[model samples]
Target: MKRKDYALEAKRFVDAAGGKENIESYLHCVTRLRLNVIDKTKVNEAEIKDSPLAKGINWTQNQLQIILGTGVVEAVYAEVQKIMEVSNASMDEKLDNSKLEDFKLQVKANKETLRNKSWFFGEIQKGMRVLGDIFVPIIPAIVAAGLAMGVSALLKQILNPSGEQLNSLLWIIVDIVTKTAFDSLAVLVCWSTVKRFGGNPVLGIIIGLMLVNPLLPNKGSIAAYNAQLDFYNNQLIEGLSKNEIYKAWVEAGLKWIGQAPTFDANGNVITNAVMGDPITAIKVWIIPITGYQGSVLPALIIGVAVAYLEKWIKIWMPKAVNIIFTPFLTITIAFLVALFIFGPILLMVEQGILIATKAILGIKYGFGTAIIAGVLQGIVITGCHQVLQGLEMQLVIDGSLPGANGAAATGSIFNAIWTASIISQGGAAMAIAVKAKDKSDKELGFSAAISTLFGITEPAIFGTNLPKIKPFIYASIGGFFGGLFAGILNVTCPGMGVTVIPGLLLYTGNWTKLLGIIGVNIISFGVAFLLTLFLFKDGIQSKKTKLGLKFEQLKNKIKLDKFKIKRKSAE
Candidate 1:
């Protein structure tokens, strides 16, 4: 149905239920309509069941629950909220000051108080946090350098096939862009993570370069020195800065003292350090560092400390930590975890996966690629399916992984289901549209028909066919068979982000792949329709027609004339 019509029809159902005054509390969890009502006696249960607005209703003590299929619940909730004020009711009949009453008052007072915060800011933060958890650790070197390599490959294919093309004038620019772009993926992740964590992102970005820093001079030299910076004669040295020296001093002092330490340097250490070489100078100045270690490893170590500390703080000072503190704590915790744990773990996993792939499937790259893409796609899409689609685009753009062959394969499987679902429901929708005794079913049929064609099956699934459960099972079974066949056939697809149908052209160039795609679509749809027809009763074949009632007269008798809208002005 059109959005407005759906809203209107839902409102009709609400108006039928004693116009919202009968409802005590309203809530939706996952799928079903969970409600608490004031006067159960006043509800017309038979009217609702016969009206076609609800598939079924069940009364379980305090709750009045209704079933509307997926995608339709949001519209129902939105319409009901407009017509009524559903508040939580206290269970304790004797309690003078109930928690439910207090919560109701709080909700009334705090309407739009929290959500007035910027949506864009929240979305950006959420996106960045997701990236930090999934991408930031391995991003610094692998993705950055890989993208650069992709460009280099493209350039090499086009302009530098052999050694002869390298001397060309354009090669210099291509070489620089490709080389630099490849390694910047990690840097981007670092900066984005720091930015999300409320740090000076510019500093975070610059610091990320330490991974590829030329200043270290030798491999793992900084780690070998335990990141100790040496100064000479109380003057600044070339390798270590004044800040580095200060940090080293603080760390050394902290080690000597159990608690946080302070430095007293005006007389003894300063005077002794002025006359020595870098080693002697550092020795005279060193004070066995204590608590705060600001180096990367130490920051990570402290971050682990902070995680445990925050838990205590939360309980110790509950009033001080509310929703407002969530962002701050999240940032701090993420910063430490990313630096210490996530970075190393992600790097190791990514490296191992890449190395293993190269070793085992370097020759049959296509087959290996398809299996990874198809399997992961299936698993990821089961819950909030869109996440895999988003990740596929990111990985491809980052260039560490090959293009989205896995994504395409998985999407194709899902798409087969979508198409089959629409076709299977077509007969049912037509039946309801043709011979339903109630005007409501005819209207619902019109909606189910359109929604199914566009790959939305909720209305048909929940409203007409799916409550029976047989159609849904059949659709999924057909989809699995069709999807598996497509995979085994090596139906290669041109990269089209995630949506499978959009990449149909990728298979167009090859007749075998094209034929396979067509075959899968046909099989899935045909099987679904046949199963649905056999399992479900035909809605269109009316006994009233055979009983000598004229079609137009029957339709006219059930025709909907006008809708009744409730007046909030009276309330």
Candidate 2:
């Protein structure tokens, strides 16, 4: 009956983890507090998991991740930091000089790679966490950009009934705000990667900027050209070939005279677009070699290369030239290597991932999508789901691609499944709320469930569903059905990140797809809710455990509350 105190909970977590002396460093993410401890033996796993505040807990990559939902994690993290600092000062005073350096060494060791072994699961975990470190911070930018694009798209449909494009200053400003994030996203990725790898961010950004330089043709232009070619090729008439049609149009409009090339998945110029034009390096090479704009992997590899290269250069590059020569040498060597080496290799890897993921979604009968959605949340349990952000962003950015039977493929299919998988958590949590007898527990369940309607699910998953296990299974089942329907119906969104109710704002201008997505979401939620309520196996027995009454059943609840209050006072 006492109010919960996060600070007190934080102190307990630290004490259970062998105090501040054992912890090397600590930080918090959206749903968990990650502690990098010096000695894993010192951590008390059983005691930590026993705390009421902890929703779930796991150890990976030599770091202890305590899932404490969302808001509580932040508060607890602050308390943990304060406790560590205070304890650290006293511990330093007590330690002798001989042991100090060794302690510092251990701390430093924890800060670097702390994976268990080279060939063990630790390396994969380390890579996944590094990926998380790179992409997690930039999620806001992706979401904001997606929302702006959605809003702009909705306004365009309403304000321009004739379907004429708008180019007013205000619209241009909106374009700038939204486009900058995608267009310049490479810089953000490079900057983040460099910082994570202990290199100068300014230099990282310079290398990033070089990738999207104006000298190269824009990637968007190439896509448009490919789409146009596809269109003309299909509409062949008057004995004109695809190249002939494109050339005629070019000649008609002298305003444009440039190479038209179709790039393969690996960024190679595989097709010549214009008629009678030789596939010369001067013509198709520039496009492949041009700016990466909106790319992820290329910039990422280049960023890491530059970071390590810069760090390596600093080892012998004398202090006098630290300012000028170090940057120049690092940039020069890294740029050449990226352009000549990592650029081609990484492009293939990036394209392969995109194509492979889409290929899975493109599987017959929606089995691939169903499997992905079923396992997505389980992946979130390990915090490695951040790796999917890039694929989702690129899919959304690609808009609708040409598909069979005059129906275009949806741009955000992955996002649609993601939303469905996540929304099911809300349903499961609400099911628990419907079963809770204690007012506080009921409130916590309801609040956590509601939070998921806006795209946050950790609270619902950790706080309400994970405790019983059945609710989690029910929610995932809901997601599986939702995903199967989503893929079959070709349900999709205009963006990524946002989901559920607010996600509706993105479904504008397409009633069929919108309705389809809404239906799947409902199916996902309803199935989970109904399953958790009716077929919980021991549903009746569990209800007697302490859940509150349903709204329609509140009369009995009132009498029950009064009787419990009286009994508590007497005790």
Candidate 3:
């Protein structure tokens, strides 16, 4: 491959996209530079596609995405950011002489565009966009953690096939990587959410740390330990349930400020009317606020409110006292709101989703599983699939999913479905490679197919399948059937992350599950390949058919005109 100048490419991209002023915001995923532009007309699409640096361009979700291959995107993005910063600085210097009213008007217009519409569905769209912005940046971390979990499971399986304990230092190291990444996920979510919502991320980190504080009772350990505690006076006493313990501790600490729960007839505690006010209710409800261990929803809710509150405080407080009061008030108010209101509500919502998912997967005959598996990729495309990671992590910790019996074992039904759904993408890409008429298209198809096998499908989806509608449809069909089979087999891996080729490690000790996964991949690939090859044809073939029909029609029309002229001459 010839070496290309990334700086020049970055400059070309900026220039073609109508310079810094036209850009609203920009971010990058694994393989694309996604930019939200103020004016689509200002973008020079032809120039961007013709540029050697860009692999492709897509305009969707109100953003212009320039496809730059992985590993190079980071460098290109850095260069682009640098160019934009320089351009902004120069603009600022020039704007010193510009009218202030124009700047104010521009700001006002931008704010209006940013404001959420009153329509409920429109607000939902905005919420989804916010989630995508916040979560996309954190996906790499989650993926890394999931891979680590898989690796740890694989190592344990290899060293201890009988599920015996391993005292190896290497196991400890592997375990650390898995635990630290998945266990502290709430912190990452909080940090990302705060930044996305325009609040100080440091405050978010503090809140997250408070939620997962080591002093709080661990939900997993409390259940087992509660059984070991002694009963007093025929009543459970001296036992630390996760909720009861935290609530009692908080009441004890705030004894001077609020009243504790009062006992009623039959020694049952009256929770609702405790202390004759909502303060007692808030204090007693503190337990659910602790250990946001596998949760992102709570962080998101808290961040959204906190961002507004922070802004409000800045507006009201005097500049001299703002430094002293802003952080104090922001933290105090946000934490209270999170603990008293949003925490319980969001936790219930989270629990509801978990129960709903479990119920769906628990259905006999695999009907529900098949439905979920079929649409898993569609969910992924909309970016809602990232939310499932929290559920998967919870499953890993609980060891609830089937085939996840061993101490080191961890898995989720979501992981199995995702794996099944992804392989079909590769299969479709392979078929395209074989059927493509253009050499460049064929090469891209081959590359995308290989990339998808390793669990990266953006290249395949964007580069090949999406551009050709029929191929994508064929691939989706393949995914559906493959997912259905996975559901029927009740296939489960020991961990999340790194599907397809790298996912083999997650099923190391479970032969049946491993075979099931292999079957799913084979079926998906074979079905997609056959469907694309036999049922779908290359774009060139379709074009040729259209051209042939047009030629025939033109020929017949000329013959008819000639006959008319002959008749006239004869007369």
User: In terms of TM-score, which candidate is strongest?
Assistant: 3
In order of TM-score, best first, we have 3, 2, 1
Q: Model 3: which residue pairs collide? A: 410-494
Is candidate 2 or 3 superior in lDDT? Answer: 2
**What's model 3's lDDT at 142?**
56
Global fold similarity of model 1 (TM-score):
0.31
**TM-score, every prediction:** 0.31, 0.51, 0.53
lDDT of 1 by residue, 238-332 (tens): 35444344443332211111122234665323222111112210111332111111123223223334444444445655575544564356445
Model 1 residue 268 lDDT score:
26
lDDT per residue for candidate 3 within 196-263, as digits (tens), equals 76678888788777766676544333322221121111122534343353243232111111244456
Q: Give lDDT per model, in order.
A: 0.41, 0.65, 0.62
Q: What would the per-residue lDDT of candidate 2 be over residues 281-355, giving only the tens digit for each residue?
A: 113354234456767666777789888999888899889878899899989998777666655554455455446
- Model 2 gets an lDDT of 0.65
Those runs of model 1 whose alpha carbons end farther than 4 Å from true positions after fitting are: 1-42, 45-473, 494-501, 532-571
Mark the regions of model 3 whose C-alpha exceeds 4 Å error after superposition: 1-16, 29-34, 44-58, 66-132, 216-287, 350-364, 368-571
* Ten residues in sequence with the least summed lDDT for candidate 1: 275-284
